[model samples]
Target: MSRSTLWLLFAVLAVAARPAAAAFPADANPDPRSISVSGSAEIKVPPDEVLLSVGVESRAIVLADAKRTNDADVAKALAFLRASGVADKDVQTDYVNIEPRYPYDSGAKVVARLQPEFYVVRKSIGVRLTRVGAYEEVLAGLLANGAQYVHGIEFRTSQLRKHRDAARALAIRAAQEKADALASELGVRRGPVRSVSESYSGGWWRGGSGGWGNVGGGQAMQNVIQQTGDGGNGEDGTLAVGQISVNATVSASFAIE
Candidate 1:
């Protein structure tokens, strides 16, 4: 009934009539229109250096004899490699194993007959080649010096990060382009970027027979010269027919406008 009370009620009614403003917790809020796309890229480059695994395996009746024979051959290999310009540090040992050889007689039976007939010891060395063409000569030299066990060889390049980035940039561009095209087709414009991701794979030579253990063995050495070269072998031991590839994937989400 009072003017002051009526005025206060009118003010309250006016305030209540106003629309409620949207309210949400930070994480609960979401942008409605968004698009996610992924793209991939690949690049190929020649491998620069070569890695060779060489070793010596010897078998004898006594562990001492086996170890002595293996050590002698390993010394010869290291000396030959050093003389050929390979650094002592570069010729690192990968593994050394000494074990007893078991004898199995006729009928798949474990015959305990006689003393342990043989002891086997193997010593492996890893060689890094800056000059690819020198591989053949190195092989021959090692062989002539009684370095008999040969492991497989691998070709690789050191510029991995550079090549990977190049591919990744291309992939990101591709994803952006695709997103733009999709936006155009859907009659929408690209808004702010929401998220991004990537993937990668690769690093292996194309050819070679048998495992590293078989490479330097007498039977395996017969084909060392016969191994097919991807690229021509030069005097420096550079087998040029080297190619490596890297792939990059980019997954991005952009707001739809």
Candidate 2:
């Protein structure tokens, strides 16, 4: 080994011995120890709108006849809805289905006949009523005009976003209160929030009955509190204007000092 070779070898050894640089510097202010807690809140408000699912069904030996009759009934229903103050944008044709109907034997098997007996046509319409008070009148009018099958009805709140925000605020407050209570019980102090997360769930509930039936259609938490409000009928005691529930849940971690 010559002097230059020895010098190169020494340099390489020194470089190898040196510690590698870190990708990032250590956190100057490390996260403090945290206490986690979750809270939920529910707000009940009278529904401001109603959605009614009305269907018209027709059957005939000929497919065209069935479709024609169904179309006429659907037209009459739409006109009635418009006259009852429902806007064009609020009324929608949900679906139209056409299928062959076959005669079945007592054993629930298709009769030996290979050809279908008649054709069945079904048309479903969705009507949205902004005025909760007029739901009954509109519903009855729809049935009398052309609608035959009542698939389902749902009551909803037009101001759902506003109510949800309010509920979230309440849930956050509840979480803070819960954290404070736990800290007090453990003889420790609660510090600033270290982290926060949230979730939500809610639906319309009829008085005495469970949640409203829909036409087409979380992790376990402890220390949860729930409350419900009463629902009543309209002024005329005819329509049951159920209450819409807006719920929110918040999970918060606070520094323990």
Q: Which candidate should be chosen as best, given TM-score against the real structure?
A: 2
- TM-score computed on alpha carbons, candidate 1: 0.73
List, residue by residue over 1-257, the lDDT tens digit for candidate 2. 89999999999998788765543467855666788999999988877777777777788999999999999999999999888778999999988788897776666544455568899888788877888777777777777877776665677777788899999999999999999999999999999998899998865542211111332220111111124234434556355565678899999999998
Model 1 Cα lDDT, one tens digit per residue, 190-228: 888899999976543533433444443443443233234
Summing lDDT over every window of 10 consecutive residues in candidate 2, give the lowest-scoring window.
217-226
Clashes of each: 10, 0
TM-score of each: 0.73, 0.77
RMSD of 1: 6.3
**Candidate 1 lDDT score at position 46:** 60
lDDT of each: 0.73, 0.75
Model 2: lDDT equals 0.75
RMSD of each: 6.3, 7.5
